[model samples]
Target: MKSSFVFLCISATLAVLTITSAAPGRGNANATIPANRTQNGTVTCAGLNDQKKALEGFIAAFVAILFFGSNFVPVKKIDTGDGVFFQWIMCMGIWLCALVTQLVLSFHPNNNNNLNQTVPVPFEPEALLGGFLWATGNMFCVPVIKCLGLGLGMLIWGTVNCLGGWASGRFGLFGVEASLPGNEAENFSGVALCLLGVIMFVFVKSEGKKTKSNETDDERAHLLFSKKIQAETESTTLKDMSKASDDLDDSWVDRLNPKVKKIVGTVMAIAAGLLFGVSFDPVTHLEQSNCHNPQNGLDYAFSHFCGILLTSTSYLIIYCFIKKNKPQVIGEAILPGLLVGVMWAIAYGAWFIANANLTQTISYPIVATAPGLVSALWGIFIFAEIRGVKNLVFFSFACALIIGGSVLTALSKS
Candidate 1:
């Protein structure tokens, strides 16, 4: 089933790519040029460029949403341990994708000057700040998941992420220029609906089995007993030692008081959402500010990814030091981590394109909230994590709001 799904995804992606490549006005430099201005001071692109840009932006956003929603599926069943090691491995994959992107941009015909020689894209150090912000937020995932569970944690962070990202672009926060959509009322309403939908997701309980950390003491003990009986031929002392080691490896979040854990998880979720919201600020700043020549969003991808890799490595080193050089590392998680990273990189790259073609105000809410719908679908159909009539009803309602919100947001830009 997984193989079939993978094949379907690949085929769909290829089909989209073929269609996009053949689309009218794509890659036409003149398409984006301001050909005229109306009496109201609104700028308009030439001919079909405006329509084409909108199409491209929506397509890129769809791809981003799909990839972001499914990126973690590979590692869903794998033991990621503390996640720091897994994140570092994933960063490696992200960096590899960035390297490939850099190479492609270098060899692209557009990079050639009047002399017909390729001009290498300059690395923008400012973009590295975005990477640092993203990696720092990612460091909180395991704790948040342990403390709040995946559903609630995602609900809080995803809502904040949608609102924060939309507001940043809409209000010009953190030195980015404000990007107002053509239809202010529609845009604001869309964002509000999207946030509402995301908030509603918290009420949809998933029936997936609890993790070891969430399991009751009796349940854990019974599981341990079963394991002991299965390995009865082995030494009892060794088994006791192994269990002790496992207990020692447990997350500190698991040991926290319930009330304290809730507070910490909520705080972490908010912080992560804030960080994720502003993670693209540096790139936006570079494009808007005169401090540096304006560049395409893709040009900054390598620098941003490099920052992620560097920050993740630094965090991993600190984590190892804190764990006395015995940080939790699951060997089985390495490949899945890399795969997740690669998928994230591709999704983020598409996000960059979407942002460039359709202002962040128009794209942020859709990208941030639509993924929840996709993920919920995955849970309902593939994972069977979400079940029961009540959950399904809530999921359907949330999907309606999100899809409606996205349409309105897109139309606002148009």
Candidate 2:
């Protein structure tokens, strides 16, 4: 009942936001406005438009933070063995959600004229690069969770991801146009505060459930004996044993030394953060470059999702081959993986909208670090993962810093 209620609430909230965001004159460039004249007889809708866009951008950012922080909750208790297969399934869900979004935008009233002529949105293949980068980063999620726990791992990577993404847009790295806010000092301070908040998150210890090694000697022995009984011939038994051996080898990460494992996990988290931080580069490039004649950021959704699905599928195929057709496939993880993917897709879509309306400079810091606040709330209230006065104090301070930073960043845009 609790899960159902939460799901309904989330659905209703998303629906409301969708309607509010899609309201006429929200972000429509060709929106017709009433000509309210100022004392000097100049049209005064520009200020109103800017204010509306800013409001929409912040709303979209809030949605992004909420969904991104909670997307993995569905799979928290499910065993996603090895993660590769699960990721591919998740990408399928992402693609499906994007397809739905594409259809909605393609048929939007804005795209139709008085005669009902529909204007088609072109698919930009360059947007696929962003999806590829995101999928690559996502491949490390399971390992990071296993090694550092979700809270610590998310904090470390979230900090890096926030900084890298904000810097790229602020400075116009990778061919994106530089986004300079009205108040540079305030913007910089806001980002610094957000970073400090993320760092503080790393210090607040959580008592979440820990993962254990799946491989056991008894299980291997049982598999060997089972294979022997199922075999009709000695050659078949040998092949079965070989497959079993390959299955055991698939858990090589579990066999690493504890110190080495932590190091590997940290490296993977950093790498993922870098990849995630730059995942929007392709879209930003397409929008800014004259070559692509960029459309709305949402127009690239389908192609971007296509890229993610294709890349994840390729990785799964490679993993299957490496495992000698013995890949660890978790039967129960499929639905949860799909649900997580859908949630992620919605969050990412909102992120694209936020970037379009607010620019990455203002959106990056808030979108990236604010999710930590949402996740912390979940840990404290829902999962009971965080306890004790010290941790609560840290959480409170971190929330204050993050909220203040976001407010400053938004003000800087003015």
Give each model a TM-score.
Answer: 0.87, 0.84
**Tens-digit lDDT string for candidate 2 (287-355):** 777543534677777889899998999999999898778788899889778877888888888888888
* TM-score attained by model 1: 0.87
Native-to-model Cα distance after best TM-score fit, residue 286 in candidate 2, in Å: 1.4
**Candidate 2 lDDT (Cα, 0 to 1):** 0.79
lDDT of 1 by residue, 316-395 (tens): 99988887798878898887787788778878988887887788999999999998887888888888888889999999
Top TM-score prediction, candidate number? 1
Evaluate model 1: give its lDDT.
0.81
> What lDDT score is found at residue 266 in candidate 1?
93
In model 2, pairs of residues that clash are none
Model 1 misses residue 115 by how many Å? 11
| Stretches of candidate 1 exceeding 4 Å from the true structure | 1-31, 36-47, 111-117, 209-243, 291-294
